[model samples]
Target: MLGEPSYTMNDLFAQLGLDSSDEAIDAFIEENKLSKDEKLVEADVWSEKQCMFLQEEWKKDAAWAIVIDELNVRMHPTA
Candidate 1:
């Protein structure tokens, strides 16, 4: 008997209403369980490649500032 079909990165992106951008893709990968190398190949699901790319790209962008600001707000509601 045939089993269920697997999902590719393209398939996932469509389902999540996300583009192949670094940020969106990375978030999805992190939420799911995929690896960088794994993503390169045709897998049954998303891969960590998105996360890895984001980790490096985020370090070079202002995203860290936003994260820090959010954390501060959460920690110091009155501040």
Candidate 2:
């Protein structure tokens, strides 16, 4: 159902132009994290495709919603 993750965490990271490897993903998250006070749409690190993917998935808000939300929460705010 809705609780199941649609995209693998790796794939999701790749779509954002981040390394898809687990360790790299972790490091990327660490390096690009929001201040626990920002949203993904506000982040500037995403490539145009990455940004579009995130934005569209956010709009879909279905199976992809969970991972999109996670990405949104972790992305740093645009400088």
| TM-score result, candidate 1 | 0.24
- Please give, for residues 1-79, the per-residue lDDT of candidate 2 as tens digits: 7576678778787767777998997787778777655567666677788778878888988677787766655555443
Candidate 2 steric clashes = 0
Candidate 1 lDDT, 29-59, residue by residue in tens: 4554434344222344424674444345346
What lDDT would candidate 2 get against the real structure? 0.72
Point to the candidate with the largest lDDT. Answer: 2
Give the Å error, residue 41, model 1: 26
Looking at model 1, residue 32 earns an lDDT score of 48
Measured by TM-score, the strongest candidate is 2
